[model samples]
Target: MKMVFRWYGTGNDTVTLKQIKQIPGVEGIVWALHDVPVGDEWPMDKILAYKEEADAYGLHLEVVESVNVHEDIKLGLPSRDVYIDNYKKTIEKLATVGVKTICYNFMPVFDWIRTDLFKELPDGSTALFYEKAKVESMDPEELVRRIANDVDFTMPGWEPERLKKLSPLFEAYKQVSEEGLWRNLQYFLEAIIPVAERNGIQMAIHPDDPPWPIFGLPRIITGQDNIRRLLRLVDSPSNGVTLCSGSLGANPANDIPAMAREFAGRIPFAHIRNVRVFDNGDFIETSHRTSDGTVNIAGFVQALHETGFTGYARPDHGRHIWDEKCRPGYGLYDRALGIMYLWGVWDSMGTSRKGVAE
Candidate 1:
């Protein structure tokens, strides 16, 4: 696997590219123009700026975590065509910078939900926590207040500008069922996949954060069959998946390792992280180590090795460790630690395989 690290850019993130380069196996940065609003066409100058920055650190800008999908596109509004055209232009711009994979999602409103951003674990290190029942009964306003509570960092899905109009947004999605959302996503793929194919950029859709519907919002990208159906929707290699372990692992039914093996070549990017799931349905993000959480990250990487997956992969949300105060799930300390853990697994597998071959 080609290791990559997620960097929020020069001014936005505390973790510098210099620090990222120090990680043993990381060779690329999964990035985006976070300041640019969704559906707006990205300027070539801005894209070039990011590329140059990565090049300075001897890193490749290969995968973008997200090019946030506009609600218009998700809701299939009349204005979606305009936003899609802009999205195509953005893809073309990214291809110019040698970016091969675009990791975007089609979830409505919130991209991912967490009950507590800095939920304290018993070990004293804090991580992102999801209380299942709390999310089920969460008031939209309350959720917004909780997210908006942290003004320092902008949460991905909960754009303050959009969340301010939560009532209308929820009302808009009320008419959109799971089937309707699927059709709209298909519509988006049909329009953009050809452009992506032409440019040699893979459009990888990230699965819904919890792999299930939240507060009546329809979520389609959760299970293996749904993924299979999504791949068949456009039937193009450019149309692919991001295959995040934390997202799908929330649902215990998903066989993550099997899914990784099955969708190997089709997967252009991956977010590998572990989460501890309780019997009561609550879950919390943990270290990349398998023993620390429910997700078998070691087995998952083994499957990736077996599939000969050379695609870009990055450690997902990490715990806030060592008194480092940053984004709740994205501290440099634990994630850097997680990378070494993942590399250890992949390296051991290589050794074992070589021994067997000998």
Candidate 2:
């Protein structure tokens, strides 16, 4: 596995490229032009700027976390064709910079939903938390206001400008059912996957954050069955899934290691993180150690090793440990620690295999 780190960019992130460079085994950055509005073609000049910065640090900018799928595309609006064309252009441009995988999601309205950004754990560290009850009971607007006001930096899915149209957006999704969403997604894949294939970019769709419908929004990329269906949509090697552990692990029924084994070849990107699920249906992000959370961090890594995965992997959301004042889930300290834990498990697996062979 080729380990990479997600860097928001120069001024937008608290963690510096210098700090990321110090993390052992991290060879690249999973990045995107955050300033570029969704559906707009990513400007080559801005893309080159990010490339220059990563080049300065000797970090390959190969995996982009998202070239976010616009709501128009997900909603299957008439304007979607324009956005789809722009997406194709962005894919071609990213290919010129050697980006191997482009990660995007088709979740409508909100990309990911969490009730709390810094829910305090018993250990005193804070992590992103999802409270099912609150999500079900709270008003979407109230939740939006809370999330937008709480953070200084712009959150990926909860962009203030986008959420401003929450009422209309949610109303728009009302016309879309789960099957309708699937058809729209297929349309998107059919349009863009060919471009991705030509550019040697694996278009990996990230699963829904909670892996379930939230606020009555339809979510299709929640589990393995749907993932199997998604792969069938495009039926191309370029079409793939990001295979995020924490997102799918929230259900406790996902069997992440099994997923790693089954989808190993298609997955060009993996977000390895752990989350402890409560009996009440809430979950909190935790350390990457196996004992710390419900997800089998070690087992997933082992499966990757056995499959001879040559794709990019990154430690996903981590606890806000050491009093680090950073992005809710993108803090440097715990993520770096998570990387070390991943390396430990990965290296040990290699060692054990070598010993068995000998």
Candidate 3:
């Protein structure tokens, strides 16, 4: 289980590459060119620049969190072919820089929806929160304003430019049901998985952020059954999953450790984080420990160990800690602490395995 950290870029993120390398057992950064719009071919120079920067700090840029697929690809529009070709090129370019996994998603418009960015926890620590009722009833523009409150870095799924076309985009997806989205995702995989396999890059699809339909947008990658079907859709080693505990754990029905074990080999990347889910369908990000949240993170890590997983893992979205004012969930302080907590569990499990072997 090699650990990686997600670092935005040199100047773009408050967490520097230098700080990332100091995190014990973390060997690389999961990154992408955020400035590049979806469907555009990544510039070779920009890829090289990121590579060189990571090298300067004794870190490897081995995993990219995303090479975003355009809505055309997900919507199955005629223009999808052009965007896919660009995506293919981007995959090839990323492979050149030693990126082992490309973590992308197929969610239509909003990537992840949280009704509150900084909901105050009982501990007085503020974390990203989701009020299901609020999300169900709130207008798109109102939600946008809430997310954009005093933050400079753009939210991953709620890109400002795309959000500007809120009404039109919403109307466009009015006809796109869950079935349509699945078929389109299969179409996308059929087109790109061959290239990914040839290029030695694993295309790891991140599960729908909250692992459910939000704002009438159909979400397909939510549970174990969906993952099983997804692997069969492409049936290639290059086609895989970025199993996220918090994302799938949003629904208590999901048996996270079971999914980890069942889809073990197929999952090439992981986002290990915890969230405290309330009975009212609300949730807030929490520490990596199971007691701190609803997810059994230690059990998830142990399952990965048991399944012989030897892929990349990262501490997923973290709370803003130490009064660090940066990206809402991408702060370094708490995430680094999360990594250590995960490492502690992983290390103990490794020792136990070794003892049994001896």
For residues 21-96, write the lDDT of model 1, one tens digit per residue: 9998889999988888989999999999999999998999889878989999999999999999999999998998
| Cα lDDT computed for each candidate against the true fold | 0.90, 0.91, 0.88
List residue ranges in candidate 2 displaced over 4 A. Answer: 351-358
RMSD of each: 2.0, 2.0, 1.9
Instruction: Write candidate 3's Cα lDDT for 81-148 as tens digits.
Output: 99999999998888898888999999988788888787777777778999988988898789988885
**Candidate 2 colliding pairs:** none
Please, what is the TM-score per model? 0.97, 0.97, 0.97
Q: Candidate 3 has what TM-score?
A: 0.97
RMSD of 3: 1.9
- Model 3 accuracy (lDDT, Cα): 0.88
lDDT value, residue 122 of candidate 1 = 93
User: Which TM-score value belongs to model 1?
Assistant: 0.97
Pairs with steric clashes in candidate 3: none
